[model samples]
Target: MLDQQITRSIRKMIEAREERVRNGDANGYGVDFFGMLLQSPVNSNISLQDIVDECKTFYFAGHVSSSALLTWTVVLLAMHPEWQERARKEVIQVLGSDTPSFDGLAQLKIVR
Candidate 1:
């Protein structure tokens, strides 16, 4: 029941994003996942169920795992201020006032 509700909600979000992308609203860092999927050749013939499944996959793997990772990283950082400072300095050096791009993030070895 709850899963169905979540799926429907996600489907609505995907439809809205698709419309927004068609209207040229997808710009800057506000890129929409569904919009990208709808446009991608890899997702040809994708149905609403597919989008829901993708969102669910993101919830299970990406969202949940990232949350747990962030929690642990915060705890570890609190225990080690020196490492935290080192991480901050490296971020500034690597990013250097530029918005974080996929390529830039990939180049940040310390982030891994």
Candidate 2:
């Protein structure tokens, strides 16, 4: 639903950025958040999923008033060290050291 819409929007944005680079107009988007996110350092191997995740994070975080929720989550996790350890183990088991993808996240039952 909403998630798909956001993914599609981010994909379109990425495509536009790639097209600009292809046309030698890389600076057309200027030095904004989106531009910064799209550019990688030399030899960086940022995948399309990585860019999409960044965009999704930025979009959702920007639209939400989540400070309280975040603080409570941190406090709860801090109060439950065993839960933290379990979540850590689950994440490691599911993703190893790789950046989490949507499917990988779904497989992390304990963390979820």
Candidate 3:
């Protein structure tokens, strides 16, 4: 039952993205892994279930790695005050007082 709910939710998001793409809304489906998956000619023979499974795998793998990386990054930053300060300065210079957008985050070379 939980799996069904998750599948249904993902399906809805996929359908919505498809609709946006169909309507020529570039901003709506801007540059994402799943968007690329949806648009890829390589995926022509793949089923929605296959895509969903791939997404789940990507999500779980990314979640684990990202958590581990974040923990290590924090610990390393704590151990290295100079690098941490540099990163902080870079973030402040790139993002200023505003919340970090994709472009803003991309501009933060040190922190990235």
Candidate 4:
């Protein structure tokens, strides 16, 4: 029952996002992730289902890595609150008012 509800919700979310992408509402984000994927030269011949299947693969792969990193971070933070504050301070000092982003991440030598 819960699985069906989750599936339906995800279907609706994807449909809404697809509608937004088709209508060019994705321009708000500057570089639309999904729009770029769908229009990519390498993916041009692939069907929508192929795109979806590839997405599922990436989602599951990322989920594991992200969850593990988050779990370990939380555990370490709980064990060392002092270190947590220092890490947060360093991150803020390096990022310095700019939002955390992929482009910004590349510039953070201390972080990378």
Candidate 5:
């Protein structure tokens, strides 16, 4: 059936990724996302299928939530120029440039 074919395809894709990971072929791969799953000690005992499932769940949820947050943030900033200006000033003060750091991101209390 269609469900079985879909499942088989997904399984094949995950197996291919796992093979790439095991073969030291990191090129063209989004290592950071996979790194998160690998960094957890508990993940070592998890099967490839389970890891793929969890990654898929996280990917879908992250995409949905981040998109919503970005949309709302843009809308709010558009509506409040003064607050947005303040935020820009704070970013320039904390970062001294347009680039953001993890440390600088933490200091962006105005955005919070």
Candidate 6:
């Protein structure tokens, strides 16, 4: 199923990250995650595989939760045309009739 594929992909990515971390690649963000596990005061022998598993779990959970929230938000926005229109109006007002510049976008507190 699709779930299995997603799990496998996440596992592969986590394994790659773990290898990079173990090899002293400081540029990887995975090093931070690994460091947190290393710094834990629990008196247990945590293996590299365990760290990679934790990373995969973290990645999958974060992806699933964010995707669900975004889907829900889109559905809600679709159901509420008035709110969508209001949001569009606010965007237009902030951007003006021209292409939006960084300063113009910064002025849109409501959009932000």
Q: Judging by lDDT against the true structure, name the best candidate.
A: 3
Query: Where is model 1 more than 4 Å wrong at Cα?
Result: 1-15, 26-55
The candidate, 1 or 5, that scores higher on lDDT is 1
Best by TM-score: 1
Off by over 4 Å in 3: 1-7, 13-58
In candidate 2, what are the lDDT values of residues 1-112, reduced to their tens digit?
9888889989998898879888998755455667655664222677778879987886678556567667777898899999989988999989998755545777988877
Superpose all Cα atoms of candidate 4 onto the true structure and report the RMSD in Å to 1 decimal: 6.8
Q: Which one wins by TM-score: 4 or 5? A: 5
Better of 2 and 3 by TM-score: 3
Against the reference, the lDDT scores of all candidates come to 0.72, 0.76, 0.77, 0.62, 0.67, 0.64
Tens digits of per-residue lDDT, candidate 3, 26-98, equal 5645456787556543436767788787777778678888789999999999999999999998988888897
What TM-score against the true fold does each predicted structure earn?
Answer: 0.57, 0.49, 0.54, 0.47, 0.48, 0.34
Stretches of candidate 5 exceeding 4 Å from the true structure = 1-58
Local error of candidate 2 at residue 16 (angstroms) = 4.1
Q: Put down candidate 6 lDDT per residue, 7-91, tens digits, no spaces.
A: 6776676566657757887454332544555433243576645655676677767788878988987897899988778878988
| lDDT for each residue of candidate 5 in 1-112, tens digit (9 for 90 to 100) | 9545655766776667657867889543343555444433343566656656766666657888888999999999999999999998887788896444344577888965
Which model is ahead, 4 or 6, in terms of TM-score?
4
Q: For candidate 1, lDDT tens digit of each residue in 5-88? A: 988888787678767756888652143454455544343676667767877888777987889899999999999999888888
Residue 86, model 5, lDDT: 95
Instruction: Rank all candidate structures by their lDDT, best first, as comma-separated numbers.
Output: 3, 2, 1, 5, 6, 4
Off by over 4 Å in 4: 1-27, 30-57, 109-112
Point out the higher-scoring one by lDDT: 2 or 5.
2
Ranking according to TM-score, highest score first: 1, 3, 2, 5, 4, 6
